[model samples]
Structure formats: C-alpha cells, structure tokens
Target: MELIVDATPTATVIRVMATRIDAPTALQFKEDMRAITAGFDGRIILDLANVEFIDSSGLGAVVASMKQLRPDQSLELAALQPIVEKVFRLTRMDTIFAIHASADHACAAGNT
Candidate 1:
C-alpha cells in the first residue's frame, strides 16, 4: 500500500495511492494507517481521491482505524470516488465520519 503522507499545519493528509480497497489490501491498509497516524496532533484527513472501490473489509478497516485514534484526535474522509462513496452511503457510514468534497475543502474547513 502506497500512501502519500502530506503534513500541513492543519492536518496530516494521507492520500491513497491504490485503486481498490478490497479484502486483499485491508490489513495492509490498517497497518499503514496506524503507522501513519502514530503521533499526529491535528486533524487527519484520509484523501481517497484515487480509490475507486472499497469492499466490506476495507470499510471495516477504515472504521477500525477511526476507533484506534486517540480521544482528542479525529479522522475525516475526503475525495471519495463515486463507487467508493456509494459503498459508504449504502453502509450508512457517511453518517459516522465527516465526508468532504475534496481534500482542500477538508483542509479549508478547519485546522483544529
């Protein structure tokens, strides 16, 4: 899993480099996310712009990543492709996480 980690004063933006987040990549995704978010103090924006698909396991991994975060920190998802977004909607996960139109929008929304 190749994750482009961008660190800003506002948030650590992690852009997924993979096209599909299916069962095969779910475990690696979790590990990468855990390692990526090990010490950040600001908001965490998961930029899924390039991700075109996500399976149930992938969704579970994303949810688990959120649960693993420290109490003071938050995880927001951004730039979800249509297919991926549909899965989130079908699973009612859109209600659980703050979804943004784009990574820039999420960054512009707040720094804290």
Candidate 2:
C-alpha cells in the first residue's frame, strides 16, 4: 500500500500508488489514510488514477477516511478511472465528494 503524499498550497494530495482498492487492500487503505491524515489541514485530494477497481469494502474505507477528517477539512477525489468513477456514481457517492477530472486540476492554485 504505497501512498504518495504531496502537500500543495491548496490541498494535500494523497495519491494511491496501488492498482486496486478492494477487499484485499481495504484495511490497509484505512490504516494508512489514518496515519497520513493525522493533524492535516485544508482540503485533501485523493488521487485515484491508478486504482482500477474498488469493491464495497474499498468504498466503505473511503467513506471512513472522509469521516475521520476534521469536520472543517474537506476530502476530494481526483483522477478516478472509469470503473471506479462508475462505482461512486452508482452508489450516489459522487454527490457526497468533490470529484475532479485529474490531479493537476485539483491542485490548480485558483481552485476553491
């Protein structure tokens, strides 16, 4: 479970280096997210470009991650592949999280 954490001016970008966020990696995902997000501030962008598939557990882990953040802090998602984007849309999670087309777009300085 490799996560590349990039601290940008507008948001902290956590890029998941792994390919799948499924039953096998869900627990590790939550644990690692908790570790990295500790005391973090501002908006957080989860880069999911490499994640091709996500199961129910994976979705649950994502929700848990968002919940763990401070209420004032925001958790956005970026670079979702087709399958994963479909999953979020199908589950009506797209309405819950800010979904971006790409990481670069998410990090754009003027974005709010």
Candidate 3:
C-alpha cells in the first residue's frame, strides 16, 4: 500500500497509489495509516482515485484507521472508483464517512 501524503491548510490528503486494496495488503494499509495519521490534528481526506478494487479486509482496515484517530481528528474518503464505491455502498459504510468527489472538493468543503 503506497500512499502519498499531501498536507494543506484545510486537510491532509493521503492518496493511495495502488489499484487494489485486498486481503494481502490490508494489514500493511492499516499499519501505514496508523503511522501516517499519528498525532495529526485535522481532517484526513483519503484519496482513493487509484484504487480500482477493495475487499472486505481492506474495508475493515479503512474503518480501523478511522477508529484509531484522535477525538479531534477525522477520516474522510474521496475519489472512489466505481467498484470501490459499490463496496462501501453495499456495506452501508458510506453513511459512516464523508464521501467527496475528489480530494480538492473535500478540501474546499473545509469542516463541513
């Protein structure tokens, strides 16, 4: 799980650089997210534009990432591919997150 971290005034964007987030990479993803987000004080926009697929374990990792955040911090999702979006929707996880069309959009929305 390769993720590019881009910090802006409004939010920290973590762009996932892989096509798939499945069983094999789920643990690494969680660990990386923990390291990247530790002590972060603002919103985190997870850019999923490059992720074409995701499995249940991958989804669990994402949720776990959010759970590990500090009380003042947040985790949001953006630029989800169709398949990945479907997975979130089918699982109703979409209701648990603030989903954006893109990272830019998420940043533009600010704290909303």
TM-score, every prediction: 0.96, 0.95, 0.97
Compute the lDDT of residue 49 as modeled in candidate 2. 96
The runs of at least 3 residues in candidate 2 whose Cα sits more than 4 Å from the true structure, single-residue gaps closed, are 109-112
Over 4 Å off, model 3 = none
**How far is 56's C-alpha from truth in model 2 (Å)?**
0.3
Cα displacement (angstroms), candidate 3, residue 56, comes to 0.2
Which of 1 and 3 is ahead in TM-score?
3
Highest TM-score: which candidate?
3
lDDT of every predicted structure (CA atoms): 0.93, 0.93, 0.96
lDDT of 2: 0.93
Q: Give the least accurate 10-residue stretch of model 1, judged by summed lDDT.
A: 103-112
What's the distance in Å from true for residue 62, model 1?
Answer: 0.5
Cα lDDT tens digits for candidate 1, 36-100: 89878668999999999899999999999999999888999999999999999999999999999
lDDT of 3 by residue, 1-112 (tens): 7999999889999999989889999999999999999947789999999999999999999999999999989999999999999999999999999999999999999956
